[model samples]
Target: MQRETTGLLSPGTHVVEVDGLSQRYHVYGSGPVCLAVPGGPGVIWESLRTPALEEFLTMVYVEPLGTGGAQRLSSHPHGYTRERYARNLLGLLDALSLPRAYLLGHSHGGFVAQYFALRHPDRLSGLVLFGSAPVTGPEHMAEAGARVQEFVERNEGQPELPRVLAGLQAVGGATDDEQITAALRDLLPAYLAHYWAREHEFKAWRETLTCTYISGLDEDLTPDTVDDRDALPSLGVPTLVVVGRYDVICGPRWAQELNDLIPGSRLVVLENSGHLAHVEEPEQFAAAIRDFVTETSV
Candidate 1:
């Protein structure tokens, strides 16, 4: 089930086979093992790397199916449901000979993490939901629209704002990798609390950021919607909900609701960050994860 990994805790990329598909997971740092699932359902794993946390935790960055070098399904751009991702997570855990491990999912991956936690509570020691929400569909879209409007108001006079707006509009219609990546890079600014102010710091990340186009539909052509509010209260795993205060997609509102829904779950809001807290405020983000792991692992 596992191959090309010289050692369990060795640093670097490790390959494992799951369901006849080769899944690669990169290993970094030392301490508790934590699987870091990147967001977007198609964003490359490198974008979610947290060097700060790697100092104290063994960060296993997952190369989720349909992204990076991982094999795509016959129904690629479709059938990438949360259930499917969760199954892959389980397979990865088993392939690694890990009975349980901490999981941190960002954005869309957070949705997958929640589904995994709900279904396989015994397989996770802890859970981290970053830039995530408890549901999706029209309501979620409405909220995101409102937040985008707020972002527009805040940066009203900027010349580049129109490009960002165009990117947002293009997202819904993007049907290929190039289009999605362009749109994503165009809208990257809004993902940060302050982008133009620190463009130099994130320009490279944006330029290198790549994504595959996933239709957000199942093989049956059914929309893979989610609503976990009713079920979260029953989740028994330790949870840490991290969010960026200015995150337009999944901001404090969703994080707060998640905290409220999951009993005993902790919430951490990075005041100076938007969607990418780990990048915007590494120290604080790392500290929150370190503290949560320290406190909950006891």
Candidate 2:
């Protein structure tokens, strides 16, 4: 089996050259192949690890370019657009000699997954858009701001809330790795359903979180905006849209919209989770994907 694809699926971490850059990926579990794209665009791949999901599926965790161990583009942070990321995913699939596979994208990674499904439908057996939306930019930002306000209202008197709010404020201007990592850590509490209530459970994870700073721009420094509303209706790949009820960024609204847009896409709302459903509600998250994969696999 290892010789069949040159060890791409043999387990552990593997580095494959894709488009002249080192594309690093980690493999785990042992079932139908499923590529997991981490959200950050700039966040470390480790942050998106789903140990529970790993139990049922062959999890191929992607180390997106410009972050973690993956090689950066000549354009560095500027050109790490969804299209570029989608293409890199294609390269990784081809490198692994996979004709098709299940794809699960979290947060920003969800954007890449949907775009990939639209552009290369023939290469996917199922698509899971986790904590994702159909668009980005002003409208998206507006909705996120409103959701953040709700979060603030829900936890007004909590002492840690201020720091979380500060972190949210810092996100837009963070220009380097250190700054971004700090901001992510600060804002993380707000990303959860009840951070203060369960600090002991996740404090270590927060302390160890790391990220890069990818400017959401093209090589020319123009914003790489996304609006897939029109294109989504045309997507033929079977899709599963999962979102946490408390997710401040891409909350239920966006997930519902995604479900409405994509034909035959199933939706799952993690009632007790925030942004990181896989972490907050691992069993439910894994179950949703496991069922989707089982039903969709040929």
Candidate 3:
């Protein structure tokens, strides 16, 4: 894979100042722009490298307010509401001078993407959600907590694993910068290999995680927080819901429900993959997205 920077904007990370926050985004490639929202409130833009995706769409990966290179609004620990994130995204789009573009979101980013679609449907050409659930119910959050507990238990006996687990827990409720960075670096390897194949490009992808926070379970969006499922049908834009069959985090069932709710949305479940289907099955994932974008663009 050839890696070259497209100087679409200023050389380094550019901050888009919004109300009480500044969102950071990386602009790369040149074609139809696709804005990608990273998973965590703390995850960075370059967590996943979509080599296949860059072939078609000019990808813009955004670090949410207070995540990655973005500036934090307050030192006080607070969970972000979906509306706040959606508005931040709108502000980012406006700063970039993008009137209408495809929106692609992963994990928690999916929630932000959905909120954007609901609040500003006029600005979106399409919506793509990967390993995401429309409404994370209480049961789902409870299950997620259980999974974290189980992961903690399984790795407890190992010397280094305990530290990593503790760090991960810290990430869930951390407000301090040092704690978040430590949590991110500790969990980097497993996360990288779990998603990408062992390749040179994979190393580049792994490097991006150094300053990024992978999603936080404490601030997850559950069913009770979501207002309406009925609004999805009227979104009008073409939608794609992709999930991993082995995704314990979001799972295939969540994608099924989203597919059912969104009119003209296509659902694809990759059998061997987990939550990070795009990384686990890059080629297949890319082909599915390419075909969908092509079909819908017509």
Candidate 4:
């Protein structure tokens, strides 16, 4: 596997020019394309890469509107709402000429995926969410933020961590890049080791870190925009919600709620894993997704 200076997968960088934006994406394997959405507003398309997914489905990892190789927006304000993200995704699909495809999302990407399913049920074949929540409640939001803060404090002294965290905070709307970096340096190691396994893929991890952090800052998780609990119940599509037993970002309760709301949806909780269970245990994650897609194939 070749590495790039940008720390992204060197093999897959296809640009789809849509609405004057050069949307960068990677296509993996061959079959029904699984359009993957990454977590944060700043996160790039590469965050969704996994060895298991590459073998199972043609995964299309997409960079959000203004990050990675995607074209920058010239507007005064950047749009970070779920609706806007979903619309961009639809545009990407249109550009690719894929009338319908499977949907897979991680972290914040799952939020966009859920909204897309609700808005455009006709364009979906299946839905899969890995370690994601649907419209995080106020209580959950505070707890999540606090946990992230604590994680940052614990790992701030590492050399590489500061840069990664600083990029993350910038994406998260932190004006003070130095402060965010200092804070994030303390948190990155635990975050990667426990949640997303950033250590294993160190070469390409910075892109993932910077993108996710910035995206988190840009996100607008309001009640009006993302009401997946109500929307998911009527989705009328095959849905899979995979949660990690040790995931603090999106705890098991979040998955349980989604499972209960979405009719016939399956929820699988992976033990000994955190937020990025797919990366931590790729084989099992891939097998589960393959089985679900196979069963739902038309």
lDDT of 4 by residue, 218-281 (tens): 3333233355666677888799999877666776778898899989999998875667776677
Each prediction's whole-model lDDT (CA): 0.92, 0.91, 0.69, 0.68
Global lDDT of model 4: 0.68
TM-score (C-alpha) between model 2 and the true structure: 0.98
User: CA lDDT of 133 in candidate 3?
Assistant: 81
Model 4 deviation from the true structure expressed as Cα RMSD, one decimal place: 6.5
Q: Estimate each model's TM-score.
A: 0.98, 0.98, 0.77, 0.77
Candidate 4 deviant stretches above 4 angstroms: 1-11, 143-173, 176-186, 190-208, 212-225
Write one digit per residue (lDDT tens) for candidate 1, span 1-298.
3333337558998777889887888999988899999998799999999999999888999989999788899999899999989999998888877888999999999999999999999999899999999999899999999999999999999999999999999999999888999999999999999999998999998999999888889999999998999999999999999999999999888999999999899999999999999999999999999999999789
* C-alpha lDDT (0 to 100) for residue 93 of candidate 3: 72
Best by lDDT: 1
Error of 4 at 90 (Å): 1.0
Off by over 4 Å in 2: 1-3
lDDT of 3 by residue, 163-184 (tens): 5567566666655666676676
Tens-digit lDDT track for model 2 on 66-141? 9976889988879998889999999989989999999999999999999999999999999999999999999999
RMSD of each: 1.3, 1.4, 5.8, 6.5
